[model samples]
Target: MKQTWFERAIFFSWYCGIRDCAYCFMSTQPDSKKAVRSKESLLAELLLCKKLGWKIGFISGGIGAFSQTKFKDLLKDMYKVSGEKFWLNIGALTADELKEYLPYTKGVVGSIETVNERIHDKICPSKPMEPYFEMFEDVSKLGLKNAMTIILGLGETIKDFAELKNIVEKYNITKVHFYGLNPQKGTVFEKSDPPSAEYQAEWIKKTREEFPKIDIQCGIWVDRVDRVAKLLKAGANSISKFPILKKFGSKEAKEIERQAKLAGREFRGTLTKLPEIDWDGEISKLDLAEELKEKIKNKLRLYLKKMQKNYF
Candidate 1:
């Protein structure tokens, strides 16, 4: 399918220092922070993005936000591939690191997840992410343009949205992404079901109503956003779908352009109609690349399974 043009496209690649994210999609136990992207693999991804005319970048790749070794390698590769222009949405960075990275970034996002410390640690037990909140202050204080993603339904209450709204008010975040907890087949929290689409949208709607400043966006359920588009009308700047995360080619991505167009009509006059998103088509055209990534992941899993079997 031919793709429609978007103002820009965000090409994402993810890694984990914690092997498994606090709420990860992979079935295996979490890995350690020491692993960095291999040059061969990183270059392959960049090469693919280059083929698709995508302005390449990286995100949610472990503790690289603190400006650590693996992150440094990731940054070096991104710059190396995209040259002077690239956008990064790395997860959980610190204020101190932002000072160093803000210049290199067209934009940076430290998805603070949830601001409540007790709850934050309870979910993300492998790492103490409370310190990462400092980056929000730095992003706002420095007037750095950035984005923030807040995960919902990973065991959070309505009060969590209120607290998150307050914290973001202090930052100059360009966008706020409300991601529904994806409890895929494996992971420590796999048994948990995400909150209902209605409930999730309502919470996001209420939060935006109370704090009607930034562009409030939703991920996963585009239809839900259409429903809550009224309360969110005054506040919502965009509607985004994460059709692809660590993986690519989701039915959701291809539908965004139509979804955005439809949602814009639904809340007509209340919201701005952003251009269509060509995310899925982008991946489909890059079929060879997507297949290669699947091959690599399968190999990696097979290798790891062997290693585990040997150790056991």
Candidate 2:
């Protein structure tokens, strides 16, 4: 069967959230300083992504200190600026919150890191597992699509795979994003190792064989670039969070491209397609306040400068 190939452009609105998930890289304690990006910066990034013809825009990351009202306003601004529906992966929202965000949201992503309640409780003690499942049900009932992110190598057992199947089926999930737990230095899992490429591939293949139509996306980090072809062959139709490939012009990126072709798939948009544009000139023309416009342009200028010096 033919597969759809695309790389989603994700916008990190903030870095830290309220939850103290053990596996999270961000500071989640009460006194943790939230590195929330300005509204202008987020709008700037979204606008640039829209101009680049990337179809999907995800407001991803931890639920920072944003109130419901503030988040809703941000969503309104995002929709107004881009004139495109976006997805949210900022943790679970209540039924009412989901409804409020329904207009601007194309879907909601639930981070079901692990299906085992014991492991989940131990690893992400502050994050409730049931809420995510509840949110998925709410998202489905609201007529919006729902997806999930699952992390492997969290001491999850083979029995968890059966539970995963049940959850996907019960929630009417359309997509499942698999990530090999990239242990951070200070996190609880710091001394632990990530799942092997083969282990991840086996589960992905099982998912594909069971649910032939579901979209399976594998998150490819810098260390696992070589696993691209293996994952593609296993059943992942798309790759996620792999910006280094396009941004850095590395030989590994070239090799991944070769592997994708070998598996008879094409990476559409952000993965392999970055158009050259006049950043300052184009951002200046956007319908935004002068101060905001300058902010966006300056941010882009710095990013471009870094990219040019180090990668391009």
Candidate 3:
């Protein structure tokens, strides 16, 4: 029996200090305290991931809680030893923080979780949705790619979906990660029902329809193969995790890879390839989409004019 190497990896260096959101799996609360992993522990994990040839890494932390100094130090350490590409989800960064962090990162991400500002404020009381948008614009201007996670069943309506579409178009978010709500036992949402798999699949279809060019990472919260197939069929190009490839064994890994390919997405480990979120490229896609729409409108107008003349 041989072990498999993961091409991509999603390793959380720390539980989000920003546990303000009710759906957080780690349940990081406002008063919740978490010990920062010692620099040695973090280095060891990164080294192992690098040694295993993990191509993509998602380094995440709770909003406003992880030390920027420590994160920069970790980035410096990885650069010295490995060239594996990476993205950071160190919640609600300031523009200056984004600027400082850009050179060391392939991309940076934060979760608005929902487009409804009221829901966002209620779910993440310590942070506002405004700053995330501000930081996204700032990051884009820096020519760094940005991504956002949208958690469904978090008090959002179809109207919010329209807003989410607007945000994607307005900011040119290169990638969108869809997380089906998983209510953690100790959190505010613990008593709330999880979003139906059907609900998630429907939204996945809507998202794909609205933003055909934006890369979508779907079913990070799903574990069942049947539902995964549903999500993939609904337009999810990627599943969130296949960590078992690195930790468990081959049988399940082969199945996940097979299903991913069947869904028209490659099992490229955890994160979408760093280059997939090319900020400029995505903005160009928006431009092209708009351009094509206008061209269609123009053709329709000419056809209508010809029809009117013939009828007269």
Candidate 4:
């Protein structure tokens, strides 16, 4: 299969949902200082990313503090402003709810961390697996694209891989996003370690061999940046959740470009890199109320400032 690399910009709309999944940082670090971006700010950022030529946009977070009507309105407003559809990873939506989102949704992303029932129940006690499965089935029947995210090193065994394969085939899933478990500081798995590079590569290779036509993406977080070349060779056609290496002018960004060339693939898109924009000019042009526009401008300024200081 031909190899190509692209970046996806995920915008967080809300955080700290009601579910207290053991592995989620939102659940473990409720008092953390990080603030959730307002829905208006999220819309402005999505529009800016679109203006910057990003082809894919994802709206991610828990279904926290949003009434059914409000969530639907948010989606409707996002599409109306950006004139683009976005994939959603908020949480499992019922079939009826899926229908409500279909008009503005490009696809649905499921967080099926593991197929091992025992580990899943223990790790994600509040999040039942059945809804995710049923959601995928509904997504398929609705004729929309669907993807699943799986976390490695979550006490999953080789046997779980077979189950994963069956699930993928059963749901006609076209994409699989593989993430190495990043033990959050306050989570139950805080002291645990992510899967080794070799372990990640092996499973990715097996996945490639098993599903030749499937789109496979390996996440490139801070700790796993060095594993890029091996993972590309292991058959990952795309990288997701990568840091904004370009903004720092780091050698790692150059190295990633060099490696992509060495592997004969085209690497495209910006990973969390905000482009230079006339904030005042952009905000003025938005078709939003003046108050909301000012809020978005302020939010964008703060966001850019934060990104300048942070690496991940």
Candidate 5:
């Protein structure tokens, strides 16, 4: 099979300080021992990603360790190597930290999973919802792109989704990651049942109606072609965890693109754009090297061609 370019990059966080979130997929917790990775190791991984032609997508972890000197040093080292290719997914950052990082960071992930304070407090006991929003506000003030994730089936309702829309509008959030809550064994929500894929399709539809201009990614939980078709029909334009890349050619990637076209949406290969925001204009504004800018422009051109081909 012919090789293809990967749309986005996803990096793992070696340390997570906020481990107690009820629905944490990684099962990180406050008392859990942190397994820190060396700065050299992370930088090497970033280099590998670049070699593979993957765009800086998003890096996730319990970034609370960044508050400590060691993790901060590791991040700085990684930044030197990563440049603006990767977006940071760790939250609880201060204004000064955000400013210091603004030049090196492409974007930040402010994951306010739910708007219900009571449920939020009950589920994520250590991580307060207020500070997260405040951080998001700070991020917005700085003109940095931001994205958030909303986990469904955590006892939220349509009203909660409405509030999320308000947050996106207020913060100028560029993208939204929607996923269903899958109970992990031994976790606080282990007994909880996940919402049916059908329910998530409805939620995606509602979110699309609310934020037509913002990109919605329903790929977190969708794995099958039928589910991909349903999500795209419901208004999701992109997916995560997809194996589409310029490396190993996956038929699934092409099929999803075909399905997206059939549903009247364009599958802009992963990470070609910022995951959190509509970065069409922002990329042009960045002070990137000319060579990098050309590469980005080419990707945008290709994306436009794909979408235009469907219409013509």
Candidate 6:
């Protein structure tokens, strides 16, 4: 039998690291803190992706709603090559901004690491949860579907996770993932312990029961089968890994795959894609999410009307 190529639709996935979240693996590298992967390097990586016939993936330290484009000049260049199949991590934004960028997005990811304001503030200082309002506001109006996430082990309470569930339920978030906080060596919380596999496993089960209507996932690294096996048993469908970029067919990457096997998880040298946080949902609801859409449209329509009348 022949081996399968990741060129198939679901297999081609990538992570475009664009967030202001406290936990970013690339930031832990030897140098270049707060680094944004260059378009030049990204373009080169895409070239390799194109050659390998494998799905493309991109991961970065910080991007999206939390930070401005590192290189606006490269947008056309990236689009000319990468086209529509890309995923981005959204940190934060407002309703108006979501409307402005809605047309260009394939999808979004609101990395609301924690729903609690104080814990959120501590994990990511100088950042707030205001972007979620815009995200909810826009996705409702524009008819966008997005993924949502909650990062565990940042000192959040059960109440915080419950609030996360309520937010997704209220907004109709299509895909929901829960991630364990991986402390980078130099970050303020570097000494913190990641949630134990057993703890993660238990939470996965509990979260599944709590949000029975939506799909749930845990970080792919923690324990692909264990952390989420019960969730799967509890009727969850989607699952994922932390999305590190080991070079295609590299020995080190292959060895990592071997480790996954030992943990009862497996990878097939396939590409994984990550999407940007739903900027459109954060901006406008051209898609008709009923209540939230009307709220945002009233604001936008008003803005347009004011423009027509030169209210400014």
Best model number under TM-score: 2
Taking the tens digit of each residue's C-alpha lDDT, what string does model 3 give over 180-265? 77778787788888677688888888989987877677644325444666777787666565543333334454455566666555
Task: Estimate the Cα RMSD of every predicted model relative to the unseen true structure.
Answer: 9.9, 2.7, 18.3, 3.4, 9.5, 15.4
Q: For candidate 1, report its TM-score.
A: 0.61
Clashing pairs in 1: 19-31, 20-30
lDDT of 4 by residue, 33-62 (tens): 434557767766666556544445367765
TM-score of each: 0.61, 0.88, 0.72, 0.85, 0.70, 0.59
Give the runs in model 5 whose Cα sits over 4 Å from its true position.
Answer: 1-9, 25-31, 38-55, 67-85, 222-225, 242-312
Q: Rank candidates by TM-score, best first.
A: 2, 4, 3, 5, 1, 6
Question: Global CA lDDT of candidate 6, please?
Answer: 0.49
Give me the candidate number with maximum lDDT: 2
Better of 2 and 5 by lDDT: 2
Give, for candidate 3, the lowest lDDT window spanning 10 residues.
Answer: 271-280
Q: Write the per-residue lDDT of candidate 1 for residues 1-312, one digit (tens) a residue.
A: 212121223323334545444676532645443444554355444543453343332344444423455555556655554455444566555666666665456666665666666867776666555444565666667666666667777777877766776666656565667767777676767788776767666776776677666556655553343333342333444444432222123333334434545445331211122124343343344334566545544443443344233231
What's the lDDT for residue 271 in model 1?
16
Off by over 4 Å in 6: 1-35, 47-76, 157-159, 210-217, 220-244, 247-312
Residue pairs with clashing backbones, model 4:
none
TM-score of 3: 0.72
Candidates 1 and 4 compared: the better one by lDDT is 4
The positional error of residue 27 in candidate 2, measured at the CA in angstroms, is 5.2
State the C-alpha lDDT per candidate: 0.51, 0.75, 0.61, 0.73, 0.62, 0.49
Residue 50, candidate 4: how far off, in angstroms? 2.7
| Stronger candidate by TM-score (2 vs 4) | 2
Clashes (backbone N, CA, C under 3 Å), per candidate, total 2, 0, 3, 0, 15, 39
In model 6, the number of clashes is 39
Compared with the true structure, the alpha-carbon lDDT of candidate 4 equals 0.73
